[model samples]
Target: MPKVSKHLNAANLIDQVCKCLDEIPDHRPNHCPNGIPFPNFAKSAFAMMHQKYDSLLTFDSDRADPVILHNLATMYHVQDQKVPCDTRMREVLDPIEPAQFRKPFKKLFSLIQRNKLLKAFEYQCGDLKDWYLMPVDGTGLFYSGKCRCQECCVKNKGKPNEAYYHNLLGGCIVHPDQKVVMPFAPEAIVQQDGDNKNDCEQNAIKRYLAHVKREHPHLKLVILLDGLFADNPTIELIKSYGWHFIIVAKDGNHKSLIEAMDALCDQEQLSYHKIIDEEQGTRHWFRFANDVPLNASKLTQNVNVLDYVETDSEGKRHTWCWVTDIELTKDTVEAVMRGGRCRWHIENQTFNTLKNQGYSLEHNYGHGKQHLATNLAYLTFLAFMVDQIQEMASPEFKKALKERARGVRTYLWKVITRVFLSWMLEGWDELFDALIYGIKPGRVQINTS
Candidate 1:
């Protein structure tokens, strides 16, 4: 049995979180000074998302069990064995800015970088060295018609009572072959302090990039994005940061650009490369051109275009087109295309896992008058980062994943919740050890006599 690295185990990771969130400035009014410490409030709230509990009430119920309370103290660094009630926790945390959560994410990411765990996610090509593939996109947080708060963005579309929703522009360091994604700090798209118009994805992305610049200015990134981000301003923002981008370009959205590609194809200016594999019975093709204007404007920005198509043994074909800054040679086109196509990983593996797998990301945990909903989203994303971090580095977590259900997180979270509730864990090590080995081979037989 290999020992999990001191820097990589689950308890050590959550303890790092404890050290960060422990400094969350006290927002409670001085009139009521008997409130629980901010660490307990913050981490107890985070525990709900980490354990995949559906509601604040559900997670709060565990406070009744002394053994579970002990485990919470042992595992999550919950101070004083006291988990706050749902209402108290929400009340205490609501006023604190969601930005506070970014600290833990930066700390965790620093660990990954300093310990060389991010090497598995690196993408390199000509002139692009030690760069990570980061997929950037937006996803909807929960929405409601009746539970409106000052923070919600309204979508009326000519209706009297507008439906309110929250969204986040998220980015993650990703790889085509890996299922686990290391997420960046998520940006909440909500009404600004004094803005009259509804908030938007473009504005959220601007803030997201600002935060990325402030937090991690040195890392080289190849940003993978969808058609919505193919516009001029988004293009210029990425370029301003000196980072590279590969964005999907649809004909309907970028008519002038696609027409330019077609014109070049007619003139036979495009270079084509194909790789056919007899073992897989498939053919991969790349056609590319460089130094084309992104639009018909006289001063429009220029990009390199690469079109990819894959043909199966049955002759069925699928195609994708992208515009990027990378110089697209025969060798480089395929790697850039893979990076472009891997943008879907943010939607499939990260967001889908949060929405459907068990995190209940869209569920309304609490909609406080202040920052409850947004902070809850941050907590959920943080929980996901912890799980992803363990998947990347922890041997014990890997072992438990195999012993339980072969890396299925839903099963892993479920058994961890049940076992921690039923038994006492001195730390995460014992729990994972119990899971890696057998908890019990067989239960006692029921007697009807």
Candidate 2:
């Protein structure tokens, strides 16, 4: 008998996810040719995503077996698999409503909040306490030559050209100390008829505002962005939504604003800083504008502007600027600076983690006409969230990480991949156990009986 330990239980992560997944609508298509139920495929695809696979179907067929649900349930360590066939899974996903996949984000967030994970990341503005910072950005996902659907936002050139795709603004509350970026509602950037030649990031931000308002109602939001989003209309819309704005104010884009800030700087009342970070081997020069006029367009809202220049040990200077609604005072300046600079957390925590850290976010999952793209994208993010939780909160897994550096720990993934081919334990718990304490050499525990 192969003694398998139940150490790698990623339970809290799964519990939070289940809170969201339970809300997914169970609408089985009556026209599924094979009469296969939809929930089985849904569960299986979700399991494949949790395992960080590029294609759920491929992972089902090639990795474990062609029986989707059985393989998935087994991988999850759940017994009694009612696995569906790959063709049936695809058919079920094709006709499913895209909105069904979204039912979970709100619920999942509620779970996280209830669990007090949200409060773990907190900062202050003036007298304001427990304020959270959310940064918003967009990214493009898929491109294909031969497949284009009504949902396809862009198409490649030539007859069999692949279609181009886009996903709209992903807003998340991020902190520099945190490993995970808690995701909020995302707006999809789709093609519109003659409204604008091409829908843009700012437009997507407009779309995101209502949903953010609906879901978060009273939640304080400080929307951070790049310079392209620092326009008068965008600022006005953000004000209308009753949210604060913290956007990049680049000299190239906000020339008038920069000029105004510079004029204010000459008056000597504005805030400024000159500091050297010996540890980082860099020096910084920073200036800020408090309650400055944004543009000549007569916008009534007030914004705080921050500017910074960095000089490396090699004598290279880099400059950046931003505008925000967060109050600027003697004490809150550093917190706001940290929040402003933490915008890179989305890149490091969300995008790069998905790409390089085993989530296979850019991999070509099933490109169904409707829900597949968004559904898979959500799953990839969910997987990253789970892994992050395990790394941070799971003492067992963290010990595994501590035993080896990140590179070596990643190399161990190859070992799991090989083990997955030859045999199956109960689930990730068993896999972790076997790795930490090797299974008996000749014992086979895959339940071949």
The numbered model that scores best in lDDT is: 1
Find the 10 residues in a row with the least total lDDT in model 1: 191-200
Tens digit of per-residue lDDT, candidate 2, span 14-52: 644555555555566364445534455665666666665
The per-residue C-alpha lDDT of model 2 at residue 75 equals 59
Clashes of each: 0, 7
* Total backbone clashes of candidate 1, pairs 3 or more residues apart or in separate chains: 0
Question: What local lDDT score does residue 241 receive in model 1, on the 0 to 100 scale?
Answer: 92
Evaluate all candidate structures by whole-model CA lDDT and list the values in order.
0.85, 0.64
User: What is the Å distance of residue 80 in model 2 from its true position?
Assistant: 5.1
How much lDDT does candidate 2 score?
A: 0.64
